[model samples]
Target: MRILLAAALLLTSAPVLAQQSPAKTMTASQDAFLRDYAETRRFMSGRPVNPRITPDEKTVLFLRGQPRAPIQTLFAFDVATGEAKEVLTPEAILKGSEETLTSEEKARRERMRVSARGFTSYQLSEDGERILVPLSGKLYLVERVSGKSTELKTGPGVIDPRFSADGQQVAYVRDNDVFRLEVASNKEHRVTTGGTPAKTHGLAEFVAQEEMSRFSGWWWSPDAKFIAYTESDTGQVEKLSIIDVMHPEKGAEDYSYPRPGKNNAKVRLGITPVTGGKTVWVQWDAEKYPYLATVMWPKKGPLTVLVQNRTQTEEKLLAVDTASGKTKELLTEKDDAWLELEQTFPVWLEDGSGFLWYTERNGGPEVELRNADGSLARSLVKPEAGFRNLARYIEKDRTLYFVGGPNPTESYLWRVKDGGAPEQVRPGTTGEAVEGGSVARSGNLAVISHSSPTSMPRTYVVRGDGSRVGELPSVAVEPGFVPVVEYREVGPLKFHSSLVRPRNAKPGQKLPTIVEVYAGPTVTVVHKSMAAHLLSQWMADQGFLIARFDGRGTPMRGAKWQRAVHLDFSGVTLEDQAAAVQALAAVVPEVDLQRVGIEGWSFGGYMGALAALKRPDVFKAAVAGAPVVDWLDYDTHYTERYLGLPQQHPEAYEKSSLLTYARDTSKPISPLLLIHGTADDNVYFFHTLKLSDALFRAGKYHELLPLSGLTHMVPDPLVTQRQHEWVMNHFKRHLAK
Candidate 1:
């Protein structure tokens, strides 16, 4: 299944070229562009990513890589002087040795879709004096005052290392078990025992990490007295082996994978003291709410956990009593469809007054303040306020910072203070259109990262009164050209749409178009930022127009819009793509209706293949990459949430599956190029093979390309460049005017 994220084609019965562009060698500029785009991770490198303000509000910490490299190093920006200093790098710690990754670390990186090396992540101490940087499986503690780092005596293969609240000690997972190490003395204590490959402690289950985005399974108490962690038993789950086709001699790596109707890993939450005593298992009805969605250990409130039922339509927020191992129900959220998890919520106030919660009860998501007992205190953000997620809550002044805007494509900084209405936060505004912005606030200080259609993301430090302080430095390379994109709302439903044409196109030219689509839940593709269209513009420069949109079954429009594909993935998703293309063509005559193509990856890959099979009148050629052929082959959490149990709603799976269409000989299959990574553990390569086999048996013509040793993400820059070239050639051959 697609991670609710990221991205053309033509249709024909047999391979026939009509007015196809001449096959030519790459130009110097084009070759340079491809290399730079792939190597820089689509121009995202060297950006101050994941910025966090230190507790003292004196420095802002971020990770930045070389302008053309993927490896990131930690940097600190002195807020007072606007000076940036490198804190740590993998090279400094490794002393010129090559960085190596454990099998566990590789799997974790795949789950997180992280390709960067060096310091991919770090943990900051609460006191803001020290930073914990985990590099290639080892831990290093870097002091804020001195630019020196000390390697903790803990053994290698550390997975998730976190700092205790007091910064005196550190906790991490190694060999599937939780361990604690005193920072000063290096005294280590095993927090849990009897951990094996099948039964692991202090780690999230596959579904939790891949689907729910809950990367960590352990939490430290505010007082640093206890550690709350999860024990996951995956003995009942089916073990699937993924072989590295390029290195088969290394043997297959077997992993516990739960399909749509299979048994998931049994996970239990437990709390143990830092001194390593008996674990107190939190009490809850695990049989009903089997999915542990989120865990919160706030500074002033009881430890809280959010759990969901198998269907994901119901969930509960329970506050745990550490002493008795008991839990009290705090809140219950239900939806006819799957309930979306809010990443930041249940923020307990320092004064123990109430907690902030995000809910979709008012048609769209809004913020609400709930009493300590979980009853509603008041609605802070209503449906019309365009509330997104809570960014921060300053307890001293009782101010809430959030992200939202007038439309789904826009994200602006918004704030509410002292029971006042939501107001737009225009920090150092000069009337330029800030397409989207995010706030990283600490106390009265904030770092606003805003972007527009013409520029890359720019960061500004601001005072409490919205006065500019200083700018965080970014070394990201400019793509050298602003993407010429037109945002539109097409179709009767007003589908959020975008169009990109060649920069030098003639006014009356009806260009062959490629409909780029994800059409998946939990993500929106049409955005107001220029970075979102760099690749689109590059593709358009290859003599084709680009049309993309967020159709039904996408988020931010409300529950009903997102749930449109609940039981009909292929039908609704493909229908929306075709309808959106036609609707856009009606208003924009430059979009050639007779010469159109479609392309996508993951869920979009599924849609691309489905379109060629069902809507040949629309999409002429398709490129399906790492596509899910059948819903039953996908994981339990994501698949079942939309299609229900395979045992109960087999029809939904059958109707939505490409295999169902491959078996039917009523129509000729449209031209297709199927791509899959042979070692993809997420949507396994078998999905593509099975569909190819079915299509071949049914006498369908298609092309299948297997990427050897590649996981779900093909992160290698050279391979990425080659892949895009193949896609462009395929589109040029089939989508010609």
Candidate 2:
């Protein structure tokens, strides 16, 4: 299952440096390294991303931008010759004009957590002849051979545009309705209508996009004869307003946000002909399984849909008959906790024999080859392999590829032929590393993006046998210094732990420590890559030590380790972190228990607040950024999965809330600082206000820094640089004694 909670902002993607206009004083405290870190987007800018290998595997197309910038332009890399050149640029299309976005486009980007501009995403047609690029509320089609970008004239407000399987038609959502365009004639056809704010068609609901990571609500059938889409009604869901308090005159924007146990959006799926006809509504047990998690229309099988219960413990995969809109139950999965939705599954064989499924039904994650009737054929991958996710399937040799490793700190590429024992796909060349690599394959070619303890991430093109072909070069500026890090498995839990120390640290010198944490689900902070600890190293160079831990509830462990956070988000997460730190102090003499501070963002933010309020004896100070102060206020899908309904599990909600700890004044509180963006929509600004209000009423002293006109992600370089400066200063004032 793919669950997404925000990690430390500095560790994730940041916006380009050119987007924000900062005040003069913002850069006054930034050293050359800090400035470079922010400006280069944590050294992510100028790196190749979103690679699409053509069907023939003769060329690879990708998007790249300027150094320290986020405006991506399309480029084509020749596979045989290893030569790359620019194909399309926003400047060429706009004639040096700035890109303007409609409100719909802006909201879509925000929900997807996309911070880049100018071709942030693109879709390549199956035929490999055409590319679809959506920008500034319009659609542009670029020819791969001619390098010509032609505006489709689909008018304005176009979103989620994609090519049909045959590449003869284009389907997109505009103003909540679906529109079909004939690629050859430029003819437009309306597929669905009667869309309004109360009920929208061909668009994903807020929870699906923000939480489930399913951005598009419409999919084309394999033959391109029909389009399956979702119709969502939020009329019964509660509406919450997010106001830009910095400018009250601009008014507030209201959204249908479903809280715990609240009425969620009523969603239904339907099929409409591309030639235009009445919709055929697909039928299912809506009351029993309300969440439409995924839909797939593979070429060799019936149309399949995955649906989940409101509580998320049970889910069913159903097969559909398009002509009659009838459904047949294919499989049912139940979990005591909650079942995670796999990001990739049901990979059908070419002859419609069976499909590959990833599941934890066997107590741990494994890959099972299921028959066409959804019965188990055999287990392809076992628990001992640490099967993380399926990478690709090579039909030519009947070989299956996946990403996994025995250790959580590293990921390796594993390939098996025809359900045989999996074997590591090691580098065929000497001194080449594939550890911590993710695979993207096309025919006999594969692109491995990887990094190790000694280097930042880089991408390489290789043949099927893992022989290096060439490198997908990166223009990222090197962070002038190497991170001095030590890795260990600490405590009885064997938590993955790492410590970043100053380069000049001497023996027996105890230093003030900062714990950069993201002890939550769906993310693991400590990795085998040096790039993972770059920010920690920078913070350590400021005369302090930085520590990180991936404890229970974080991913890459077995189900038992992850489900421990179930029903106890606050206690379990904080307990593991506090214990890990205490255990580390015992083994590492340089760590001073009395001089420790904690900081995190999102779930990590919640952990930080929990530590500051309840475990002040361990943490001297804390910083919580974009935290969920109360579980009751979070979205339905993510919250209910762990804590169940707030009404039924009131004790769980209270025990897991920072406000519950804030209300208790019997114990001394640690120095606490809360940071949030005023315009944040995911973890709304109200979360911080709620906690501060509770603290004020209880006479607890704290600090709050409200970032004006920003969202959950502080994308601006100047602002990020200043934010870190403030964080370092906070730790210095409290932990440095």
Candidate 3:
């Protein structure tokens, strides 16, 4: 039965992914497989992303595609009336015009992995009366009440357009220069003149966007008088060329890419007014701390910015004086490992009396409500060391909402009222055993999305009093198959692990197991949402036991656990995966540890490749997709934060790199399949070529699959589905012993 089920899945799957793009002449079964897989992903993840409730809580603004349509449209959901209506659509706005994106815009979306066509993002005004949507270099402002939109006509190649608090003016960056457009006059005013070929007035550099999550470089003052933006100069940054082999006529595009140990883009902060005035440069020691992590201008405090050193070990929350442009340190946070940067809301209290900051300076990760002058008043939660965060505060109940827990696998929604004890709102949020979903509150209503491994996602509208109003109407299609999976902590380390057996498995049967892992910092293997692990479930349905474990170095556990990979990414991460397999096999007896294999992409890909080379006794066969064979080949921001300066610590760099271990012939070799996209600029397809070269030199024969015109994160739904299916077939071929 197991063999037959695997054969059925492989009928539409490729035994070996063709080097060329998937042909259009696929069989009916293959076409149907791709379509079903794509639809499942599109629907299971839910259509709406970045949902925002208006300040009044009367309506919710979100972006979703129209009824499984390719193009996404802006929508507004009326809470009182319980009606969802489309505000704007791509067809209505484009009006048959060709959609052409500037290179900068394309890079931004690529970093975000945003595939939705039309307005992928929007900025809600402070008053919640307007939203600024930038589509294909053009700006459109939509009124909430009237559902009317008018083109701002800011300028060519406009990006990062934001609205002032009063909604009377808009500050936008166009072609590296800052420009302000007054709503009433419909006139554009240039705010800065110093931007040059290598410098930008208001834009995040590549590192900031890709690693820091600081998407926009501009911020508006609460009084709607001044705008604070970053000045990025990339003259010192190194450049890398990316050429599309498919279109040689277009030639290579050279972009400023700062690799490990290379000079990063010089950054500075400047303040400009809406009415147009001289730019006030914020004074800070840029040489000591080049990375600007976060910028905040809360309603109740001075402009605060968080800056970090190149190694990311230390950070300072500085308060900048608007008049002199000089900064004073509010607090400093230092860690033996790299400091983390998070996007937090309501930096200040309601009256702006004090500020709320989340950091590890207090011995563990927790939120702190400081006094007006930056002195710690008290810790929001007790001295428990676990993952917790400040989401937002409910004014009516005086409750500060947060998400996290001591268990790394699971996180709960908790709230604290006026420094009282913390209350758990959603107890069962861990990916292991899901009961409820994550919650986000706006106004008097909270938007709740719930799901489990065996169920579809359901988003509900809940009142402030904890009563469900109704389900938010979603047009997403349901999945073709339901998932059957279970969670366990089989090791003494209490490893948060999961095992997805074949949905149609017999009562007592042994099965070949494939361990799917990420096992790196800031990435979790277990999530409460069923849709999050859909691919793993699909792999399980194909007659192999799919396993995932949030091993050491992953987030949500505490400072100690997350920092275990401080300088050694190859050791703890791999050992935990191997141990978990043994532990799970001990518990379930039917899990065949001898026939075990490992597979993953990116960091997980690196892990899979390492297991195949270093631990062949454990992982017999591996699928390494877009693996980073060397840490030195990655960007400076992400790599340096972990391994430090490659020049200063050459030995550490050598030990951390997978190429070093590949040369060791005595480690034993296993069957390995290397997969990568030619156009993957992030991991750089060069890593795969180098690894393949190392394997060949070591006299190890391995399979290689190269994808054309594919970035690190392939955006096409059809391509993603087929690519995953092909990988499943590869595992079946080798692991189906």
Full-model lDDT for every candidate: 0.84, 0.83, 0.76
Question: lDDT per residue, candidate 3, 1-737, as tens digits?
Answer: 00001111111112534332332334454456456667545464346656777788777777776544557678788888888888888777789997778878878888887766787889898788888888878988888778788998677888878788788898888778888898988899988877865898888988889898888888988988888989899999888877775667878877888988988999999888767788788988788888988899987788999988999999888899998899998888888788878766328876878877787665567777788788998777654635456557755566677666666555555667876876656444444433333344442567665566666666666675557666666777776665666877879989887777776788668888999878877898875556666666667766788888888898776678888888778888999999999999989877888789999999999999999988899998998989989998889888898888888778768887889988887676777888787777788888998998887787776777766677787656656666676676677767786
TM-score of predicted structure 1: 0.95
| Global lDDT of model 2 | 0.83
Task: State residue 501's C-alpha deviation in candidate 1, in Å.
Answer: 0.7
TM-score of each: 0.95, 0.94, 0.92
Model 1 per-residue lDDT at 105: 83
Q: If the candidates were sorted by their TM-score against the true structure, best first, what order would they fall in?
A: 1, 2, 3
**Which candidate should be chosen as best, given lDDT against the real structure?**
1
Candidate 3: where is the Cα deviation over 4 Å?
Answer: 1-34, 39-42, 66-68, 383-389, 395-397, 426-443
**Number of clashes in every candidate structure?**
6, 2, 0
Q: Alpha carbon lDDT of residue 615, candidate 2?
A: 90
Kindly give the stretch of ten consecutive residues in candidate 3 with the minimal lDDT sum: 1-10
Alpha carbon lDDT of residue 408, candidate 2? Answer: 82
Instruction: Residues 28-126, candidate 2: write the lDDT tens digits.
Output: 333777888888888888988877778888887888877889899988889899988888998888887779887667788999878898989998998
Tell me how candidate 3 scores on lDDT.
Answer: 0.76
Local distance difference test, candidate 1 = 0.84
Model 1 alpha-carbon drift over 4 Å, by segment: 1-26, 427-442
